[model samples]
Target: MGQGQQEKVATSLAGTVGEEISASLAPVDAELAARYPGDPGTRQPVHTVYVPGDLLTADTVRSWGDQALAALDEHAPDAASLAAVLGLSDDLAGPVHDRVRAKLRQEPVEDLRVDFEDGYGHRADAEEDHAAARAARLVARAYADGTAPPYTGIRMKCMEAAVRDRGIRTLDVFLTGLMEAGGLPGGLVLTLPKVTYPEQVTAMVRLLDAFERAHGLAPGRIGFEIQIETSQAILAADGTATVARMIQAAEGRATGLHYGTFDYSACLGVSAAHQASDHPAADHAKAVMQVAAAGTGVRVSDGSTNVLPVGPTAQVHAAWRLHYGLTRRALARAYYQGWDMHPGHLPTRYAAVFAFYREGLAAAAARLARYAERATGDVMDEPATAKALSGYLLRGLDCGALDLAEVTGLTGLDRAGLEAFATPRRGDLTASAG
Candidate 1:
């Protein structure tokens, strides 16, 4: 092998990467890279507050969810003051408290998961099912009373070989109790945690379909969420991504794929003390999850921050700080939703969420508006940019962090479009006719 300078052949080199490159991306492909929650699933909540089934009651919304509203109310002197407190931009001049009150009253727990798994723990089967039934009754009452959150559901234990039947039974009994008592809420979802195989998701879909058929519920009434906790769920022994397989197996009933930070980290042998949202392994898994769910009508949610906001007695600042940091991490990963174990996490959740949207509002809105008008600009905007832009705004609005007025100027979407942003593929911010 003679080492000599070869005659000058055209040498390839990396080109400049910036807003221009990113702008040209299609919404779907761009979402894969940016992790924006697309227009597939229901509007993601600011957070999913999971309460143990036993604690739920027909009137428990005030007790359980009010604490979160209180958390906001306490810090929020008014909309402007609260915005300043949260470091939100000046554009948020309206009354944030009114939004907080509406959220508290209407859908404080935009997505409420009655946990029979980790949050509830392995208790007596009878006791667990009874609690589940009770939770269903509460949901029914809430629905009848017009107090139901926009999205609500239960988190069953893992569908492992050891307890598959039990998980299925609990889910069935809960649904049975719910339907017989009053009726199912409009946004009923079931979360199957620690899923290790696609077969598990398929099994759940079958179970849900049967329930819908039997109870006169719509065919796809029982949307599902999978916990990507196990290593196998992310990658198979054959080195293939199983997350996609799981979604495919859901057969159109799949809605959410939630990451389990602590469980996943623990499985990888990380000490309990060290496991957190930003762990490299967790990041890689969530990235894989985001890519798998992109454009498939499936939403991705990050895991919870085990660090509760607490001090000697009801500490707020420390909890807020921790929640803000954890939430910021999740947002950076483009996870618009995650689990909330406590009420104190609410304030920080909104603060961080609002900040995230505000920080990018100017740029994103401008790009989106230009894309909608001419479909070309200083930054290339594809159809994908439309979805991405609309999704971003919808997530913010759905969570009460950004109002329509705050977004309209930048997005060039009217009130109708803003209202429809939360609906599935409705109110598409990009208009060809425009």
Candidate 2:
């Protein structure tokens, strides 16, 4: 063919074959789009603070912040002290300590859940109803007065036959209270605990659907986290992955899958001392949950540690070390969120998170910068790698570990540009560089 001429091409099949193929795959295309809508591109909380429903006051957030600061003051007063406890190097100790302190002061708890489940235990109907309504009123007022955490809600009882009706009633009372207090806050979150079957998830959907209709809210406005506590929630009797089906059964209302470390481990017959977030069973369940939720607009949260950083300074330091190490491990495994049970856990939570992002910030920024500029380096990165790199920085920024100016200066890409790469669509993946 000449330079200015086009080459002729021959086809083996009829022209209508192309249309026939498209028609045949149309349903599949729709299914893919519907099932895998991708991440919602929102800020996922790094930790969820669970307080018993009756114990949650308007001052709970501030109280946690104060207690965390006090713990730091008494146990790890300086950077060197904290560094010694958590085994941080000289470079990270100072910055991590400063940021953790600031985070405690500014936003102690990113997400707060008033627990009506195991944390609250089973209570009488009247008492539980009052607590649920009280939670809503307090949460609403906190949000109104700008004192609430970024996210707040209640974790109602499970859908087990024993507590199903009570759980529904609590949710109803809570939502009704919120509706009466005004509308639901944008940060409102709900957790349906101890979900063992997909049918329970579907039932939750039906209940939320009814609530939305009764309140005249938009369809699917409310979404809840599924608490995977039972062995059946992870593996069905038929040996199938039940968590995946739970996500499907949610019908687009499953916001997250939270691993219930203690409940799940107990159900698997793991002894009390062996029931930890880093245990093999917990890892297996969370791994299944992570794979099931990937690209499905749902987040996965690890469970909590019962070890509180209390007692003497040595004991406190030991607990802090344990918590810090587990948090770092979880972060490396892509579990960005977990449960924080005690106020003393706050300092270590932020420390582990801040250190994780800060330690990798420069490398991630450089790689992303190179990718954005289409430059070659020792490590050649593709679109997916770029996505991961940008995602790392974005998560850092979201959690206050990295600042916008620092990221922009290092990568030469603003927040919008980074977000574009961080959440690219299916088509964008192919022509991302272009």
Candidate 3:
């Protein structure tokens, strides 16, 4: 009897809608606009070269800390320290170059990746090393205390089993403790070193999944970004497919994919010595990743420019960059994002980003127009049956060719019209996860 009366009340409420209905409807359209906003006409090209100052010393780190804390006092918030600029050869000649290294770590960079290669020094444990433990504590303290640089994450050893095992084990302890202690200051993303296959990513995902579950944290709270540093990742048939499989495996959990230009070049034996990130081969790798992840929502970032141009003067470095063709080549690549090793590279990063969006918007507008024409035809053919039209419209939306309102305007139905495309008449959308 109570159930019957409750049903009657619901029915009456549905039928008696008046001012309340109008009031609620007004907000729905407003909310829709809030959500979509007509795409901002075009998105700003991602110009972030997430610099990772991986090799900064305790004193250099301290200097940056002092600068950041001081900036917090005055007006403009200054940038974080630059990536530690260590000469690869270090075969030293006249006069020591400590001044350059000191200055590099003084300027604040967005994201700094500490390199673990030669000169970084290693742990005796091999497994639970001092370096790994030290990095964790540094990250926890920096981020936890709100003293972290603008944003930070580490590119640990890549794909080798030893590297992977060490990274996973070390990260497992470090991150677990951080999460227990209310998590790192902001967020953390581990960059897999020499990623050759999808299984490596899948393994990391599983470990992260287990770690989150064990810590009583939200499952998949931790995200990972894979580095396409090996030749395997560029193979359309093999390596690329492996990457796609990994993405599929970590469907909701993957953050982004980055091209490790130098490492990838190394895999191909492009240079007997060190393969530079700005090398032509690296450009090819960046383009390949861009093409592979085109439709996917995954963010793509290019590797850093390997060369560290000398001096503090902007003109000196600007001339060097233009002469080397490093900035333009990486900027021209399909990937909108790249890595910044030196804080001095900010100008180039900003320039390339703005240029990319300026060029992309017009092409996007044209493509969207074509998709809309096809969608209008589909809707007209079967006005009542929205499946054909809805699918096309949704596809267009995914491609950023059609905005929700524009698609709905043409179809003469709201976003709800896409329900049929997602779920058949007898098919309820919320039935089960599968």
Candidate 4:
């Protein structure tokens, strides 16, 4: 046969050696792809309302948010500047107020963490255990009565070397009691504070496995979150990514990485006078958290504003202003979920969250409609963008920020389209299995 016109290049290896190079790269790609922590449920709540363990009851959450509502009633601002501070577009001021009131009355606390870590401080071990067990019973009762928050859980003490045993004991007692009374509620997960090592996460996983076995629940049924309080949780002693190692150690059980305001700042040796969520150090840590947790399905939560709305009664305006300002700042940074330390923070929380959804509702809906109309458009319509847009709508509907009619009317998307948008995205299947 006559040789075809071929342009030959110099080769380092003969024959099928080139094929071996491609073959070798496949296993490395597979190993790297295996490291990803898959997506979490999109319906995660926007805030966790923490109350002292002893003080939390189903009725407390159901009926406790009236003070903030009354404050809003009395302070009907006429000035545009004040309205701006509270995130009120003149068009939404009244409806937003009504929605805030309705949200407080209907579901004041979507995620309630009966705090024993900082909100409920150190006490005698036996007394702490007793409180936890008692709280567990109340939670179980709430579950039976359908009064529990949609997401409810407890925050045990720090699980460091100093108090690991005590923390474990309290966790065991509370969970055991909860299991005996009624199994855990939907979205129930433990919160482990002061995580500085991957071993802590692994130990927690092992402990949860033990509890599930003893209680006869399915393995991996108990999930927990780690608090990124110290800088060590962001960077390990040997200079590895602490967040990555911790999630890997969780063995598919870690759901969140909650920021701790005071503890984190104090760990950095910042004085109380300068300690705030907006501080540069805090921002750096939160940025680290966001970067580490992004695409890993691990939620990142901002810490609470300790500047609570407690008053000489005259200082209510100032307190609300500060709370609202801080909330707006956090929302700007994509930390939709945060902490509410008091009942009085509820009005501002709802007000800020509603404003966030309302402010962007127009743009998001238009973009979503435009993107949905065509498979590809000028705006990127990748799986992640679609997921986020759908999730934003779902959040509004679930939290009553927008009614079904409002969402459909605005987005030009029907119920089916919204539902399809909310479904988790499956990864690309074009790559061959290695």
Candidate 5:
């Protein structure tokens, strides 16, 4: 064959391969599409709160769900009572079952997260002693008995050296227990802590893979989240290589990378006696995580503010909550899902979430709309692409989403180029706006 003909044949083969790959990836694209189905203009934030049982009294724990109910009354009244879900410890259940029952009687959150750290902590033998199993059963029974809190599942110890040392075997044992005891709650979320490298996340994934094989569970049945706590994970030891490896490792199964501000500061030699969240080091650490997670579909969530100053007067409490809301929104705008440690933090959670969506939707929609019209075209109108890209810079700046330094980093179009892009053409570019 002539060289030209040979090139043609090679092109044909490459095209065929591309088609096959696209066909295979169709389902995956469909899943991602469905996963984030809202219009960019109306995207609601996914606010997943963490409730620690130790934070509340048993009487308070049982009576605890009222705040969630009140929240539902405000924003998503018909959306279901998800905020009230308990993170029941084995100890909490004995004291607060009835109080929890009263709330469950109203409407149960979709899933209840049982804190393994509270009960099991570093005890590898807790799995054998059946405390973990019993907790699962009690939660299951609560659901079965109509006093149940929707879905019941366990949150294993992610930070404890026991699981880290056992590696995948720890998860193996937990999965075994869940299976032998019938099944898990609605879902399993492995809360990873002190994650300094991507290898830690990869290890978790391998364990999930092994668990699937051992228990006959389908692939991708398990989901995990990394607590972006350690200084190494946030600020790389070897320039950007560590952060790159971290993002690469966290790509698939990671739903979101959560900020462990407390632990992160602690790891940085911040005194445990010091208030971790308020520390400047903590702010810088979270910002690092935020920047790392930018444009990555993996959602970023800020850690709890942790100042539960519920006081004497309603006026004083309201003022405190208002400040909390403003702070929460600021954090959310910085690209984070707000973490509600206390039920009282519900006000802040809703406020921040609403503000994020309200602002994010409008900003994304405006920028995307401009880009869609100007820069992103099929043919010779590539100059329009420059305009659209410039719009992103303006939108990011206007919305407080990105500062000038970050904007320059994102676009790489220097001041001169940006100025040229911003200047309008004489006639042809001017279009009618209805």
Candidate 6:
């Protein structure tokens, strides 16, 4: 085997073979690009607080924060007390406790939904209409006055025949009120609850389309969450993933798939005592939602627990432990967001979130730094892993779990660098990797 005479190897395929294959699969490629566009690289809130429509005043956000602080003052009193109640490790106790209080004083609710469905219950048409319009006015003013959460909107009733017209009227009044009060806030979010069929999602799309037209807003300017309350939303009669179809039917306006814990559990006939976010039934539903939403620019949010941290200190401690444990478990399972039904849930919510991110920050930073430098270690990583690592750190930063200086110091990557790693196109991720 002389070097100059290496078997005279030559290509067997024609030069146009690659081009022919690519041309043949062009439509498939386009479909893939359109359907699986990956995450939108926006800031996803860690939790959404649901308040009844009638209770959502302009000061509701601040009121919740104050109430959370009061709860902390009366029950926990200090970081050590909270740490004891929540069973936090010594390493995490001080920082997590302090951060929770600070967060309560500063930005308590990351996202808020004025609930017109289950939380608000059935009301007269006039009363519901007034509440909807009032919610919009107050929310708009909150935004203008710089007191609103990062995201705020309403959760309208389901598209079920019984409440379809009422839900439509509420949504119309809300959006119209926001428009009349100047304009819809950029943080506006809408939730269509108890969705069981893809056609229901299509109907929501049509409704929003009409709203945009009436207001002269751009097409696709509005997006809403599809709440998975019914078991049929997860599995259709035809044995298909109805939730996935719902996302498609949304025509690119679906921003999230929110689990409704109690309703979903009820739909499956789970016992009231066993209906929880971590229940086996809930896990199956959220798992389906997660898979359906992955790479489709749609987020999945876990449902809230009914347990409120109130009453005696012992009872409050028990409830806090439950909420914190559920939240931590959800984070481990990659469900980054959930619902907070009570102001008392805020402290434990932030505590669990802060602890989760802070506990893993150093390891994530080291791994990302190694990847950035193309260095080898015990664990092997690829572009997708890098994306995940960067995304984790970014979420931490977005939710105030980690500071910019600390993250940059540990990873040696600025915010821009992290964003670059986190948001590249799927194909480009591997294609551009060295």
Q: Which candidate is the best by lDDT?
A: 2
**Candidate 4 global TM-score:** 0.87
The deviation in Å at residue 259 for candidate 5 is 0.5
Model 1 poorest ten-residue lDDT run: 424-433
TM-score of each: 0.80, 0.97, 0.56, 0.87, 0.56, 0.96
Clashes by residue pair, model 1: 27-384, 309-319
1 or 5, which is superior by TM-score?
A: 1
Instruction: For model 6, give the 10-residue run with minimal summed lDDT.
Output: 425-434
What ranges in model 6 sit over 4 Å off?
1-9, 428-434
CA RMSD of each candidate after superposition? 10.4, 1.8, 15.3, 5.2, 14.3, 2.5
lDDT per residue as tens, model 3, 137-216: 67676766555555455655554666556566656665655665557554465666667777777777788788878867
Q: Write candidate 1's Cα lDDT for 1-434 as tens digits.
A: 34795666685554555555756766756545334345553566767878887777665556655777666656554677555555555654354445555656565566788888878877788898788778878787777777777777899877888777878888988889887986766678888999999998888888888888887877877788889998999999999999988988887777889998888998899888789888889889999999999767688998888777655323565566677777888887788888888876766676677677766778877876776577666766555455667678777776776778878867779756644533433234344324
Between candidates 2 and 4, the TM-score winner: 2
Candidate 5's C-alpha runs over 4 A off are 1-46, 51-63, 67-112, 118-124, 127-129, 138-154, 159-170, 180-187, 241-243, 271-279, 314-319, 330-336, 355-434
- Per residue, candidate 6 scores C-alpha lDDT tens digits across 126-154 of 99999999998889889898988999999
lDDT of 6 at 299: 97
lDDT for model 2, please: 0.95
The model with the greater lDDT, 2 or 5, is 2
The weakest ten consecutive residues by lDDT in model 4 span 425-434
Q: Positional deviation of 256 in candidate 6, in angstroms? A: 0.1
